[model samples]
Target: MKAIQISQFGSNDVLTYTELVKPQLNPGEVLVKNRAAGVNPIDWKTCSGGGAAPFIGDLPFIPGWEFAGTIEAVADDVEEFKQGDEVFGFIRFPERAGCFAEYIAAPADQISLRPDGLSAEAAAGLGLAGLTAWQALFDKGNLQASQQVVILAGAGGVGHLAVQLAKWMGARVVATASTENHEFLKELGADLVVDYKNESILDHVNNVDLVIDGVGGEVGIDALNCVKPGGTLVTLPSVTKDEVIAAGKAMKVKVEPIRAEPNCDQLDRLAGLYADRKLVLQIADTIPLEDIGKAFDASRTGKVKGKLILTL
Candidate 1:
């Protein structure tokens, strides 16, 4: 099998596309022949010695977490799925699953059957980002219907999905994005779009029940002001600073940082939404598996409007 692996952490040039032995399955695991792999910031960040890099042990590591593929075989303990089943999910996030290769041995409970109408590229894009948005809004933030919410980086992978999910839950959605993407976000069900480049997000919106902060740092810290006195502020990126938590406390608001995990139940709900045409995935670009280096470069630019995928 052909895979992109890194013997050492550095730039995108370090990702080498070469042949590697097909992975063998373990108990309660399924061997998937990957058809598409999502290229997330975590992928490039890990490769450059950031994000989840510390969890990646040894050299010659393969970086990728979200993928969609067909099941080639299953371990003895697995009973829910059989060979030739189409599935998609985030594989063992915060731990290495080596999804950049053609085959991945993922736990059966971490994945679900793909919606019939959903393409492999689209399914690949949904796992990590979709789970991140869903967990941030519903589980951590406790967002409710008819409430107002603000989503930062509305055009991003997680942010875009957050906008749609919030709308589906009947929340009045307000989002921050560049002027160029304002219309795009509105189409995704955002009721109001704040132009982060030209206008202050705090000035345009206030007294929101929840704020999903996808762009952590000073921006995420500033979003604390957008929430109401008792509202919650959920930060998605693990890179959130300590000051954000302190600031939220001072403001009498709940501040939480979230890391998306593998959840087959949540993935099933997202897949149902896709089947009903209530959710849509935006694909910024799809590159061949051999050109993963260029995909990393594009992800590093931080300007992609949607998810990038690697087709096998």
Candidate 2:
């Protein structure tokens, strides 16, 4: 099987496309022939000796956390999935799950079946960002219907999804993006769009019930003022979480930093939403598996509006 592996942490130069032995399945795992893999900031960051680099164990590691594929084989204990089942998952996040390869040994309990209508590219991109948005809004923020919510970096991979999810949950959605993406966000169900480049986000709206802070640090600190008293702010960037949290504490606002976890049940529900056409996963670009450097460079810019996928 061909895979993107890093023998040492450095830059894009370290990501190598080479042939390797297939992975062995565990007791409750399924072997999947991957069709697509999602490229995220964490993928590049880890390869550059940051992000989840420390948690990924030793060198010569595979660095992908989300994928969509078909089951080639299954462990005897895995009764939920069979050979030839189309599946997708966000698994072993902030660690190594090896989704970049053509084959993956994924835990059966951590994956969900891909619904009939969801494309493999869409399913591949849906895992990490989708789960991040879902968990940040519903799980951590406890956002209620009819309440207002503000999402920072609204045109981003997670932000765009958060806008739609918040709207679907019956919340009044306010998103922050560049002027060019304002209309795009509105189409995604954001009721209001604030231009972060030319205008202040605080100037447009305030006293929101929840704020999903995708852009952390000073930007996150500034957005803390937008949350209503007793409302929650869910911060997603781990590198700047402490600064945002301390700022939240000084302002008497509650801040929750989140790392998206694997929940097969929630992913299944998200898949149902896709199958029903209630949810949509935006794809920024799709690159071949051998062109990981291009995808990595694009994601590193932090300007890609939607998800970047690698086709196998």
Best TM-score among the predictions, by candidate number: 2
Give one digit per residue, the lDDT tens place, for model 2 in 1-312: 999999999998999998989988879899999999999888898899988887898778988999999999999999999999999999893234499999999988889999889999999999998999999999999988999999999998999999999999999999999888999999999999988888888898989999999889999999999888999999998889999999999999999999899999889888998888888888999999999999999987778888999999
Tell me the whole-model lDDT of each prediction, alpha carbons only.
0.90, 0.91
Clashes of each: 0, 0
Candidate 1 lDDT tens digits, 1-312: 989989888997798988888877778899999999999998888889988888878777889999999999999999999999999999873233578889898889899999788899999999999999999999998989999999999999999999999999999999999889999999999999998888888898889899998888889888888888889999877666467787788878899988788999999999899889999999999999999988888988877898999999
RMSD per model, one decimal? 1.4, 1.2
Scanning candidate 1 in windows of ten residues, the lowest lDDT window is 91-100
lDDT of 1: 0.90
Off by over 4 Å in 2: 93-97
Deviation from native of the Cα of residue 150 in model 1, angstroms: 0.5
**Clash pairs for candidate 2:** none
TM-score of each: 0.97, 0.98
